[model samples]
Target chain A: METNNRINVERVEHKTSEKMKKTNFILTAILLICLPFLLVKNPVWAQKKESSLQLSFLKKADQSKNILLTVKARNEAGKFAPAPNASLSIFIKSNEEWLLIKTLISDLGGKASMKLADDLPMDNEKYFSIMAKIENDSRYEDAEEELRVKESRLTLLLDPTDTNRILTATVTQTGNDGEPMPVQEAEVKFYVERLFGKMPVGEEFVVATDAAGKATYALPKNIPSSDTLGNLTIVAVIENNETFGTVESNASAKWGVPLQWEKDPFPRALWEPRAPPAMILFFAIVFGGIWLTYFFVIFQLIKVHSETKIK
Target chain B: MKTTKTITPLIACSLLLFAFVHQTDVWKAPESAKAKKNPVAITEASMAIGAKLYVKECLSCHGKKGRGDGPKASDIEKPVTDLSIAKTQAQTDGELFWKISEGRKPMPANKKIFSEEQLWQLVNYIRSFDKTIVKSK
Candidate 1:
């Protein structure tokens, strides 16, 4: 009886120990799984300030492949301040992979600018992506910004259409074969550079590019010119565009009326030399058409009368 | 050397399986990807833009009806999921956007090509096939 009791007790103890061992093993496994989280220095309460990067393309004149990246970090004052001496890794996307172009430390103003003599090899060969990244910072978390810009040109052409001036904005992007391809359905805005600010040229705020990548607006008459020669700077811009950033081309045209012209007026019944000559031509055309019609009708009536008499 | 019949059949089966595996892969989007909401509004203008972009960029593999039966669908290695199917429609806009932006083999990541709003516009366009499925956020 003593032996049986002892055996039973040992069995029970062994079972309990097995269960405890399993429990301990599971608890240890759980701790091991969460060990990385616990060991990490940047916890939820002690996280660093987040950094932000902004990228922009600065196309020189009507052509050039130049890009500028801006990096900022939220300072103690909770404002975006220039992240000086920050390492910025610039990458271009090609073949669905990020090709690191260069790593340039940002200047004091947080501007990292670079000019590419040739276009980067893009996936589609037309549109390209430039990504800027600032990683592994001590005081700030990692940040990345990407800008997708299509290789394009904005041409501003000022032409005289009859007595009025027509401003044409053409947007062209590089095709697969490295030829100029017209971009359709691109929204373009026309602006006249005024002394105070930029004055929108057409009545409509935005005009979409046609199949030929052209948007034309007839310059309104009597716009005040900056100088006596009636020359004003007209700018064609594709502002805040997804494919094309704020691309603008300026051209000088004699579309605006000189201040002297605006003041002089006609001096005689408010009709000038140019207006009377054009007005005389207009009236002459109307009278000439009317007389011709009347003469034709009378001639037809006389012929009908003669024919009836003969019959 | 194996028997002629067994060897030929085994070789053929291996090639077939290889092709099948490559063509039929369906990757799952992460939880963060599923939680994304469509930022582009579902309006006539937005849908129109989406339609135009779809025709230009996604028409090759997705097909005219988004049925994954496009002309190039067979040529592509990855299985083109039918965009109009209920399985696809049940997914959130962000999930679709994530899949498009971060593609696998034979499917290029479109984030390099399109902007954020433009990808949302594509999601809106894809949603047009079945209007009843998507609940706008």
Candidate 2:
């Protein structure tokens, strides 16, 4: 009975070893079949993502000043990081279409600046449309941005003979067809041009344009001019707007009613130093007295030394 | 009968060759545009106005001589056509007017910006760039 039990156990062990070998071979074959797929890379889905671009005015650019366009780029991680060595194309929208004017490359900080040419006819339009674009980047898709340039021309008219010296201004906006159209409801501010910029003319500085795109302001009697001849340069300004940035025009007028205070060269108060004659007299007297005392002291010392030596 | 068969095949082959040799331009204007005639009269004044407009609007992409060698030509994906070339000059004024109004990609539509008279004037201006033809005339 013991010999019969030993033979049965040997048979069971042989069957178990064969089953283990078969399982190992099957797993090895499956791994070999899937190995190529595991090693091969999938298409770069990250590169297909859309790139983002932002445009801003670099400095205090205005209608009178040349425009400085600044462009910034964003990375794949949604971070506003510098896109160094990237090219950005700048375009200006004319009457017909957008014309590519210049191309700029970003610096280490991913900041690119493009200064518009000074001679651009900015007075022709109330708002200029500028576009910046980055095309066919390997890592990022195409990106572009359009920004509105606030610019316009203001025409100032002065009526001097009227009982109420009214300064009238007409605000005009240029259409895409290069035609000037009246801009209604635009706030036009009148200023008297001075050596250091401009001074407001009257209490009602800001007035909105009427239906005919005209704004009027009553000029005060005592506005000062640059010269004695009552010649004044009055500027009509449409201040900065979100759409139409800024526009200004100037007109010369003989309406400057010079103040009596401006005409007088001498100051009325002691603090006001208009080459003070009283101060000059006082200084001369004080200086002369001190010098005379010094001279007297020197003469006495010299006489005392001479007499002592003789003795 | 043999000669007739030979001539037929030769004629058919010749026709095929002719068709291949004289392929039409890739861009085709609408039937209405193709049939229409230019309304604006071509004069020195109109050409002068068109010249100014072209310089301001088209000089960057289309060169001063209409040679498609403007500064921005290479940056654009599509090859800019040389307006001075005979192939471009062969197109009717109406066709050119239609294309300018309804622009393709990369080129903005100019219908809003230019009036019908202005577009017609542009056609005259572009034709003025064909000095060879102008001299011949």
Candidate 3:
């Protein structure tokens, strides 16, 4: 009876060991299958932590001085992620040229602030563009904005009666509702195409418009003449207290008297004589010398022939 | 007689040269008279329309205040634009109108969505940033 009991106990122990082995194998297989998925998902997790960067500008209350540029950066999770080593650049246009005013790094709060020079002369009469840049990993991404400087409205009139006539130009600024806005001082620039060995010249006239928002300027003496004369373009520019206080307006009219094909008489002399006084004197001297020499020679010949006949 | 022959030819050559130079100085019209017309004005009504449109389309990239920090700006590889600079305010109405109509790369043209008048209104709203016109009060 004791020998039978020992054999039975051994068989039960063997069955238990086999079940433990099978359980271990299944767990190992499941881990192998899911390993790649977790590894692949790692980058997506990192992306969520690395994607927050923002930039903005702060306008001063008075709006008279330099403007403050605020650049904010955060992680993909929208948390403030300070990029202490990150580089920042700010550019501005001054005197018709683009100038890099400052470069720095963001602070601990993931923010960078810069002050742009307000005294910089901005010609609002023309179009202006600005750009800022920051490094993102291995690449550089930049933000850019192009704008037209605001200037007052400018009106130019061309006289249709006379070719040599001068048309007056008037400039003023209007409010948001088209009402006359008060402008301390504004510049009205006059320009025309260059023709007949003349380049289009620009003249700047600075004047404060009256309560009526009107400032008048006399046109330059030599206006460009074109065969297809239409409205001559005039530009008015004003840079006020605001960083973006640049505005411009244009007005044109028919230039010179319209010429009829039949009645349009071409000038008898297209070009004014450019001969120097010295050149005229030189020609007169040469011709007079030749005439005197011929007369003298003829007189001598006649005298000699008459003397020979008398002899 | 010999002097007359030389002087006459010299005078004729000079006259020819003068005539040629004078003719070259005459003004001629350009081949085509296609001049770019003035851009439309930006009005307050257009700004109202642009503001509504901004919420619908641009608010995703450009924030509620036209700042480049919109919700989607963070995900894109490119940095968003900042619209509050003096340099930006310095731009002409025409230039701003052109850019909005024919957007720059990365920023698709809004022309497909907005009419020309709406675009002009947007420009006007942008110009409202001028301190003299857009007071905080």
Candidate 4:
């Protein structure tokens, strides 16, 4: 009876071992099948959760100065770090579409800077939308941030329709995108360039832009003309404006009262020729004296010849 | 052989997907725009007036024959749509008017420059490009 019990127990243990081996084999097979999915990163999943890029803007001191921007990158672990050597591009929104302005590379600290060209448009109000973007980065998804800048522009027009010689100076305010925007209550000073320097014109040296972004000054007809063609160099200046820095527009017009030659106050006596009696008399006396000396010498010769001939 | 079988179907599917994606990118007017009827009647006199206005305004960009080959057409970043094409003619007159009144980038909005009646007339003039459509009208 003891031998029979031992055999049964060994058989039961062998069956149990076989069952355990089968279970281990199934688990290993399942793990092997799913290893690639678990270990290898899926691009679709990576795209769903893109990397975050943070951007900040530093306002420029003047509209003519460069605008400063800073960029920082965040890792998948949500840690902020400088994105070194990343490519960045700047763009401005024009008619709802972003127009590329410039491209730059980030430094080791993930900082990038750029400025609008001096000739490009900028406005005082956030009338312009500026965008900064990071491009072609695999480790981090592409990112962009938008900022508003204050850029101002001024344009001057001389009304050609005014027949009354009314020196009408019109000032039009424009934004960075070259859109005419009304600038109410901003003082605009009009000046005419002279041989020496700019001379302020109009009874009111300062005028204000109306609701239509237009400021009209009855350019006093008395402003002296600068050229022979009756052309005047008119300058519309807006200095120390809170919105727009020193903005000025120079325009030429056939307006302004000409510098009348008759009214010229400078003394031209030395250079200008005039038939003055005193000068004419001096010239006549000098010539008369020379002629008189020549005639007397000729008369003496003639008398000596006559005497010699008579001897 | 197995890899070839898999890659062939994959490439075909990718091409089909690409074509489908780009097909939807073409700008299309909303159903609301399609439903709105033209208020102006198509008439020869109106076309004459619109033709004059087109020469003054759109001729620089849309060309004399409405072929999108005007002098300034190349200066714009976006390609000017050929008004003589069937695709342009397929749009309703109201949709054309709306597009002109509320222009997109590289195109100036003419809402202030042209009146509502004038915009409708321009729609008629653009439609006159299709002789069949003109004959039917």
Question: By TM-score, who's the top model here?
Answer: 1
The sequence of per-residue lDDT tens digits that candidate 4 reaches over residues A53-107 is 4343332323344445444444444333456777777887776788887888878
- The CAPRI class of candidate 4 is incorrect
lDDT of 3 by residue, A61-102 (tens): 233323223344445444222455456665666766777767
Tens-digit per-residue lDDT, B38-137, candidate 2? 9888888999899878876886677656756455654566656678778888889889999888887777788889998888888889998895885798
Question: What is the two-chain DockQ of model 1?
Answer: 0.02
lDDT, candidates in the order shown: 0.79, 0.73, 0.54, 0.69
Tell me the RMSD of model 3 versus the true structure: 33.5
- For model 3, the local distance difference test gives 0.54
Q: How far off is residue B137 in model 1, in Å?
A: 20
**Candidate 1 per-residue C-alpha lDDT over A1-311 given as tens digits, one digit per residue, 9 for 90 to 100:** 99999999999999999999999999999999999889988776567665657677766455677777766665554445567788888888888899888889889876788886575776654678888888886666788878888777989887754366878889998887888999998888888899898999767857899999999888788688988888889888786566877687889877788856566555534245555566677899999999999999999999999999999
RMSD of each: 28.4, 28.6, 33.5, 33.8
User: Which residue pairs collide, candidate 4?
Assistant: A121-A176, A122-A151, A122-A152, A122-A176, A123-A150, A123-A151, A124-A151
Docking class of 2: incorrect
Share of native interface contacts recovered by each model:
0.00, 0.00, 0.00, 0.00
DockQ score, prediction 4: 0.01
**TM-score of chain A for each candidate?**
0.59, 0.51, 0.34, 0.38
TM-score between model 2 and native: 0.39
* Candidate 1 per-residue lDDT over residues B15-87, each given as its tens digit: 9999999777557899999998887888999898888888878876776567564546655655566777688
CAPRI level of candidate 3: incorrect
Model 1: per-residue Cα lDDT at residue A263:
68
